[model samples]
Target: MCLNKITLYLLLFCSCINESYSANISEDGSFQLNGYGMVAGDFQSEYNRPKNMTLHADPTGPNQDPRGKMGDLGNSFWHDYYTSLAVTKKWTGIGAPEQWADYTYQVVGYGDKALETAQNYGRFGGLNFLPDESNIWAGRRYLDERINVFAYNTKEVHIDSGIGYSSKNFDFAVGTAQIDWSSSGAPMAAEGSRRIFDLTYRLGLTEWGITYVKELDNPLGTGVQQATSFSAKYTMPNYLGLIKGQSSLQIQYGKGVIAQYLNTSRISVLSEKGDSSVRFTVDGSISQFEDFTVNPAFIYEYTKRDKSADRTTVIPDLAYSGGDMIYGYENETGIFGGVTVKQNLHHQNISMLYEFIVNNTRNKNGVAGANGNAYKISVGPALQLDVLPYIAPLASLTLTYAGGDREVTLLPKASEWRVGYRMEVWF
Candidate 1:
């Protein structure tokens, strides 16, 4: 029960359940309610190896797991919780519109195990004729918007019930999805249904988008699976001199099926190539100092898959799968950079943040020094209070440090250090 008294009794039981659910919301007519909730606690430390340090060449293969190394060390603890709720209604009888109409209903629930596997229902309910140009109804939502940090970003779609169309620049949506590969142990695949489409275009600070997916009936017999994604973004405000720029680009193409784990015979192979990636990023921001603010960014990525002479097989060592070396089926190219700084004290309700990142990987079938690099840093301080008047409370604490090598751990080294805490309350 120690661990700082279980993190101070889970932060006083999540601030007494957000002050008893903040008096069950609902105020001022025309039906409207709001919500937000968050809680986080984390601790991490890494590096731990010994026990024959092996990737098994049959030194008892069945017991091998632990070679995603990169500065290895270990220790961990976690806690997470999320909540959201929204309800809105505005309209007076017949013909609805005359001025601002509304329709909304939302719900969300989350957990990190413990609330007995907590899981809540409905999230994203809709209906609006001129609700910002157009609207429809849906259940889950966050329809595609490509952004990546570590692969898997073909415009992350998530829409259960869908329909959309917007104006004042353009936006569109169409959906259907329910794909679960059972935690992706991927014995081929299971749990299926997919169909989604997205499109976007915005002028003025520039924007562009596209998304498509169709993966019907995939019990992993293959059969059907197609993906496409493209994205673009641009911004420039007071360019150069006062700095304020932004850039983004993304691309993806696919034909799915990936699951490589032949760790010297723990076996699990299912390759059916055709995967691609190209990512780009550029960032900027500078606020002529005063209360401080500076942001910077850079990123580049290139991923690939679709190489095989029957996907090789002939092992007894020389292992390293998925990022390959399994007889040669590799891919990876990255270049990352980051910087973030924010400062605002007192008058701004306290705030401070710092971040840094650096990564350089290369292993497209390696051989020239096989490149590798990694770096990360974080710092934090935050406090926003407004105790009552619909309550508002927030807290933060962060510290992080990361490590690298073997192009970020293809085993042979690793590192980690993390400390986190977060609390929030809102109405």
Candidate 2:
């Protein structure tokens, strides 16, 4: 790993000159290095939907995200693989008695069938310091660390360049990004900027957060195109109040720009007026037994958007109304419920895993025969290195059934089979 010692040292000096700084990231000064990513290959017998789902007629589903479908949601080989490598250095007991400073840089990337097609394109780096009782940070960072579910990371957070301050239990941050997005993810000029601000407070076992988004310049001529997001979450460290596990419940809502909860980076783009979304999630993991464990999650989401129809003007005969017509708002409602059951089949090192998901997303305005619902089940045996910290290799065979409305698959029901190999880890 390449180290930017100069940058880290310069920022470490920041709090020492101030004298009032007091915080310790760790017991002593240390150099910390960590990274996480996934490598996976998936194959399907026939062509099918994209890696994520596009709920019909809905502005968005799963927290107002057209990309509601994720994890193993028909993700092809090309779409299922990515990696992130990060490095961090913390300086403690170096200056001002007890001062903390952190420098981190992470690079995310994607690959193709050939090695040469791979590109490490995303860059997230930042400088963080605790000056006095407040924590100050800047640079492109993962804003909201709280996630609805660990499997798919469904939540709202800005992954852009910004600065933030946190003191006591109150936190505030503002970030800006380009309206247009590219794979490279390089920031653009602020001519037409997508700006975001977030404020959050943690009280006891619950967290309350709100986010506001605005477009500084809109090429579509939509004035004050904006969106807002709010969420209330409660977290419990133990399962059933006694077992060894963790669980959380979250309720979320978004309007205008429509919250892209599934999006890990980049601000959500402009949306048609009157777009709104709502979501509820419960996620938990139980490791009550040494040889058996389970992770379960349930999600319900709804989104609404208004469609427009231009009035017929050139031909007077078809004109029902002299002014433009509003086609009324369309709504989408869906539930994503699933569970992953893990059982150790070997000498407690080899595990058999079963993951099942039921999806039912609908469009109120779609044709009578149209709906987006699927049932998927994936089972695999995993081999984890006992000496290592994570599950290294897990290959699975997946069966997916798409059946809801006849219009969805042009038939009463459709089924597809897939084989996949994946190794995911974060340490």
Q: Which candidate is the best by TM-score?
A: 2
- Model 2 residue pairs with clashes: none
Please write out the lDDT profile of model 2 over residues 32-144, one tens digit for every residue. 33444565555642233333332221111111122433344333354445554444556554545555666665555444322211111121123234434676778765553
What TM-score, to 2 decimals, does candidate 1 have? 0.27
Count clashes in each candidate, considering only residues at least 3 apart in sequence or on different chains.
11, 0
Using all chains and alpha carbons, the TM-scores for the candidates as numbered come to 0.27, 0.71
Any idea what lDDT model 2 has? Answer: 0.49
**Candidate 1 residue lDDT tens string, 1-427:** 0000011111112112343443333454556555666666555321222211111111112112222111111111233355655555554444443334445555554443322111112322134434554544444444322122221122444555576665668877776655443222222323356677777788887777766666666554546555555667766674344444434333333333221111011112223336555566665566767777766656565556566524433222212122212323456566666666768774556687676666676752222345677675667786786343225777767776766674444434576566766676666
By summed lDDT, which 10 consecutive residues of candidate 2 come out lowest?
1-10
Model 2 stretches astray by more than 4 angstroms: 1-30, 45-48, 52-66, 73-76, 112-134, 145-151, 182-192, 219-221, 240-244, 259-270, 308-329, 346-348, 364-369, 388-413
